[model samples]
Target: MSSGRMRYAPTSKLFIYSMSTLYVVSPPLEIFEGLKPELRQRIVTLPDFLRYPAGRIKGITRSLLAGRVALPRRILYYWFPKAYFDCLVQARPGDAILIYEACNVRVLRAIRPYLPERVPCYIYYCNPVGTTFRRPAEELQAIRALGYRLTSFDPCEAERYGMACTGQYFRYPEHQPDNIDSDCFFCGLPKDRAGTLQRLRTRLEAEGLTCDFVIPRTPAEKLTYPQYLDRLARTRCVIDISQKGQTGLTRRPLEALFYGKKLLTDNPEIARYDFYRPQNVFILGKDPEEQLRAFIESPLAEVPETVRAAYDVNEWIRHYLP
Candidate 1:
């Protein structure tokens, strides 16, 4: 495996690298779909699932290759084999290759001696998998030595890894599923039905901020994206507390920004993200009572549109993605 960097402008050069094959082992098609045209022309997708049964797997694969099924251009080697390793070794220099999994990175490292020294390797990160920032010394040191640039779906996660001393972290645009109805105020299961939520609600109510509460549990109850967006429009403030305690600003906070809804979250750690501590989003301490009351009593409609736009996805793309 060669360690080097290659840059290609979309216009003058498309696929300047010798090998055109690109192997993606993850779900997001958005990242590579934007690749230069010539590179896209010679791409193969390896399905992550290949071991179940030849009849079932091969039949589906044939159907896909036959154009009966729709899949992104990529290839997945079902079982690891020496032939795969051999092909990697024989791969021409300047072959633009990418592997997105830790296991695959480990495999490539195991055979590093056999690979050319200049192959550009990029590692995609989704999450830390195990370490929380509070306890991340060992994992931090190991990732730094891999000598690969890191790209992640979540900007906050990338930032967290950076804090832990991992590779340089970059944010790749996320593939937010269309299934999420952006118009709804509350996504996820209701706190009432999930006893823990009911308890939290009880505590909030006891504090006397008696606002209307909506809970959407199952798929059927989930509002359409437009509806969710509309609900956020109707609300003065939205909540973005996480089940995992105080951590990164989850998708909910980002969604809150998209809808331009003011937020009151229990997660103080959200302050780590850019545009967090400004007038648009507020932090609620462990005892959310006083702050919650003050916010409820304050005139929220007076908050300016500029403040609301701080969470705008467009702004996010400009600041983080670009």
Candidate 2:
């Protein structure tokens, strides 16, 4: 199928290239379900090679070779080139390819030689800088050298790594519930902040406020995307505990806006955004109990439609895949 070009602005010289197909090279994520119907149909999700028996054996062999300093882990793309080649070869001119995170460096490397010159390749980094899981600077530089457009939700982190800041996006619900039952809700892995989150939960319950806090002890305990959204929809306020070194906006803030639920967060940097309102978002700090109590008693504030539309899934997809 032939793709088309989308003009975003009259004054701008840049033209957003439309894609006939999108090859998402990442582990399965529920976010893909939010894609527009036309775009969703063209998606091709890549499988995790380490999940298969043959692929698992290859992974072990590669790890052993890298452990002996014989081969750099990044240059071991030849070991798993089939998946990369399969997708790359099918990408016709004008098609778009998105690779999530820097962990897919080996796949990107393997596909570079097979990639169509006219096809656009994009890389998205969702993690913060200074993390062991993040991509190496040299590897990112090499990817950029190969003409792949790099972007990140963390604007500051993106700039530090010389990538474009695309911000974050979330799927907007078709219907918004009018009744809110719970005072506050939060669900996530209890990484290093387990103690801090537990204390907050205790304090909220002590004040007779209803707080639905979930820290999954195991993978099976984790809530599905729809279930998580349902909880957020029923709550008057949502709590966000940002990970260490996190400077970018997470999905919580966007969800809060879409649902008109107040936000209780520890990220001080959120106040800098244009959408920040003291009545809508309460930053967690000293005397959080006092702040939480005050916020819970106040009426929810309305977010401007313009601001909300800026982060809408349709708008975000246009920006990312246009």
Candidate 3:
């Protein structure tokens, strides 16, 4: 008997050179799955050869060797460094290239000689200036010269560094609970600071707010993403105080706002963001004893519907993806 199904189908199609191949380099695997699972099915992960002592050439060589693995028609290499640009340049004309970080302008420039003349390079950046721009001034200048279009969380940071931003950085929306689980003060203590948290705990106890608080104790100690969300949900309020560095709203305030809890942060610029309000976030200085007392006694209710409506994640995703 004839195999009718196999006989009827053809595996190959006519050659079409005009097809599209979108490449995303060094992107988070979670986000990849979220964006388009079908697309990720066609992804080719770049190896971590850049971690080698000899830099790009060695890394590129390693990646080429590892490339015995099949490559997708629409290829994506996650977290490859600038050194990999040469390999990207050698890719098919219809192939797309994505750059995840703007920090490596120097590497981008180095590959200027090889960048496909018509390919578009996309940058998705999420760095506060103090961290990414801390290298020598000359290196910083080199990054600026490359002039990659950027996506960042804060416009002010991009302006401060003399870089133009294409759009705002997108993040997943905060999902807060309707009821408060515990009456407690939750603060993240600096691991490097010896006895600092102990002294602060002692002072809070003297003021009658007596709790050791949930703080990570070891370098290996880390909460899973869901556990972190749970932590935000359980606590009535979050104390956001950055003891060092340029204080912007770190992740804490965002988490607090989403959980519909009060936030006590030292950063004044937080007021400018859509999340902060007198009822929700309270700005405090070095000593928050009085303010902390008032809050612990009577916490604010759930965030208003109007405010919640404004912080939608869908809008953020549309803005970034579009």
- Tens digits of lDDT, candidate 1, 159-258: 7556321221212223333332221134455542356456656655676644445677567877665555455556556776565422545556655554
Candidate 2 lDDT score at position 309: 79
Best by TM-score: 2
**Candidate 1 versus the native: TM-score?**
0.47
What's the TM-score of each model vs. the native? 0.47, 0.79, 0.62
Query: In model 1, which runs have C-alpha deviations exceeding 4 angstroms?
Result: 1-76, 80-119, 131-147, 150-184, 188-196, 203-236, 243-246, 272-274, 277-279, 286-322
Tell me, by lDDT, which candidate is best. 2
Model 3 clashing residue pairs (backbone)? 26-78, 26-79
Choose 1 or 2, whichever is better by lDDT. Answer: 2
Q: What ranking emerges by lDDT with the best candidate at the front?
A: 2, 3, 1
CA lDDT of each prediction against the hidden true structure: 0.45, 0.71, 0.50
Which tens-of-lDDT digit does each residue in 1-322 have in candidate 3?
A: 1221111112221111223444445554432433333333333334332233256765664455433444332332332343343345654555555555545443455444455666555555554555565662454566545544455555665565554554332234334557656544454646443365556557556667645366777755756656656766776667665544443445567666555567766677777776556766766553355666676566575666656544433343433331
Identify the superior model by TM-score, candidate 1 or candidate 3: 3
Query: Model 3: number of clashes?
Result: 2
lDDT of 3: 0.50
Model 1, position 220: C-alpha lDDT score? 80
lDDT digits (tens) for residues 195-288 of candidate 2: 9899889988888899898899998999987899888999988999988878899889988887788898888889988788889898888335
RMSD in angstroms between candidate 1 and the native structure over all alpha carbons: 10.6
